[model samples]
Target: MRNLFFLCAFLLLAVACKSPEARRPVQRSSGSFIKESAERNKKLYKKEEAIINKIIAQNSDKDFESNPNGFWYFYNVKDTLSTVMPKYGDVVTFTYDVKNLEGTTIVSEKEIGLQQYQVDQSNQELISGIREGLKVMKEGETVTFLFPSYKAFGYYGIEEKLGANVPIQSTITLRSIESSEEN
Candidate 1:
């Protein structure tokens, strides 16, 4: 009986010593979904850009400048003298309004009254275009910006007035910039 037990243990150890095999996935991904999504985004961006460019071309009177961040702007009140633009932690007070490409007001300045934001420091609810636009502005300067859908609202738009993936024009007036360096 002891010999039989020894034999069974040896057989079990021998069977357990077999090298493990790597697991194979039941189904492999072809990466087509990712590629297709990327292609779709590229096309959407191009379409929006074309529409913005056409608007810019039609309004040649304004000296619209293209930002590398994928937007366009023309300063309604450019402060040539003041070299001070808001820096990190500086508090800036501004008022802004949004309109469609057709120049229909979607959000009035009165609707979004005096906005006080800390430059690059606050978790304030501002869009990407407005955030970037604020960094380029000096106190007492007003600029009109043309933002693509992604920069403005992207997939989620303003509740009822604005729809998803729609470009918009916003005019911002920088009232004051309280320097953080003072404190």
Candidate 2:
């Protein structure tokens, strides 16, 4: 009688510990979450593009005129530095001072040092504006090009610390310090 009582007690305890459902938390379907995020990103991209277009329209009347060969112009120089710009495979070194048209120093190379960038057809290393700017510069020329937010950061601002709605109408200036020597 005692043994039977002990076995029954053990079985009762085991049954009590068993869970009616699995031990893991129920997983949500990722497809729905991904779709929602993609829609949100598309909306944000459109908003950013609209702001950039507005800035481009405003700056269109500035000194530089857009040319088939160059990105954007600051002044109407027939022999713009871009006339001798580098090709995509060329490597170049440069110093730059990026500022708004209002002369707010957004970035300065004197404070940071010289920067080197390679011309990449694959859009791997440089922004489209910078690439366009470099295409029209000589080895020892200093040129300034303005980049609307669309050309600058677009819908996604600087990936690091710059938050959203940071105004895409800001300007940037770049100077070509040297052209790399070909081996």
lDDT of each: 0.95, 0.56
The lDDT leader among the candidates is: 1
lDDT of 1 at 66: 88
Q: Which stretches of candidate 2 lie over 4 Å from their true place?
A: 1-30, 63-78, 99-103, 121-133, 136-161, 164-183
lDDT of 1 by residue, 1-183 (tens): 999999999999999999999999999999999999889888999999999999999999999998999899999999999999988889999999999999999999999999999988899999999999998999999999999999999889999999999999999999999999754
lDDT score of residue 74 within candidate 1: 98
Question: Positional deviation of 79 in candidate 1, in angstroms?
Answer: 1.8
Q: What's the lDDT for candidate 1?
A: 0.95
lDDT of 2: 0.56
Question: Residue 105 deviation, candidate 2, in Å?
Answer: 3.0
